[model samples]
Target: MKLIGSTSSPYVRKVRIVMAEKKLDYRFEAEDVWSEQTQIASSNPLGKVPCLIMEGSEAMFDSRVIVEYLDTLSPVGKLIPQGGRDRAAVKTWEALADGLLDASILARLEATWPSRQANERSQAWIDRQMEKIDLALVAMDKGLGDKPFCSGIHFSLSDIAVGCALGYLDFRFPALDWRARHPALEKLATKLALRQSFTDTLPS
Candidate 1:
């Protein structure tokens, strides 16, 4: 098995964390998605990062699909619930967190475009996206406040998704001080980081 992605991608980081937690052995092929000669386009028609190529089968793209498949591979430390309302909650968390990351990444790339500058950027749009992100963070804190994990006591895919989202905010929006403002959320992130999965897969 081989995983194709770049280190700086949050979605790739999520897949890497799942692989580590599953204790799976697979070759990692880091590809620069922007390069003209990159293989990502061949493996993934969408030309996306975090494409998982199995030994002799079609590769898997989309972090959600890849992570779900990985959870099925192991009976230990299940990252997603088997089936129930609990599963729905976990998926919802993952969706919201991933959405926040999607918006942030778009805003970040646009801000840093060669012809673009901070002064030329639209603070109004960025602020609106951030408002949504903050609201999601607060909702996550309220919904998963007492639990050790997002869905329950056991760690699930939600934790991985949320952790990656928060990590990206720290990486790209350092001025926000998310940890300080949201201590409960920070605690979750801190605790999750102690796990080998999170520690090993941190974004570069």
Candidate 2:
């Protein structure tokens, strides 16, 4: 198995965290997906990070799919729930987190472009996305109240997905004041993020 992505990508970091939590072994191919036409784009056709090429000629794209597949590699620790409403909730959390990343990345690219090409008109679009982020945080806090992790009772894939989301915000949009606003999430992330899986995979 081989994973191809850049070190600074949150999606890639999520896969790395899953691999560590599941204790799966694989070769890593670090490439900037946005750099140029490369093997990652050819293999996955999405031109995205965290594309996993399996040994049996299977190419898995998207962090969610890649992480889920990697979780099946080990028996001791399962990152994603097997089935039920719990699994649906985990998938929902992942969707929200990944959506937030997409929105953030768009805003970042819009900001980084040449001033003439910059889309200042899209600030409202980004603001709407931020509102979704806030709503998702509130939902997570309510669902996670007084619990050790999300999805109730176990540290499932939901936790890792949300953790990566929060870490990405910390890395890119520190002005959002996430920790100050959500102390519960702050403590939760602080407690669980100490593991090497979280610490080492932080966005650079």
Give the Cα lDDT of each candidate. 0.87, 0.81
TM-score leader: 1
Which lDDT tens digits does candidate 1 get at residues 1-204? 899998889999999999998888888999998887887788999999899999786889999999999999988777888889988889999999999898888777667767776788887877777788888888888877777878788888898999999999888888988887677789899898898888777778
Question: Residue-wise lDDT of candidate 2 within 57-100, one digit each (tens)?
Answer: 68898898888878887885787778898778889988977887
Task: Please give each candidate's TM-score.
Answer: 0.93, 0.91
Which 10 consecutive positions of candidate 2 have the poorest summed lDDT? 112-121
Candidate with top lDDT is 1
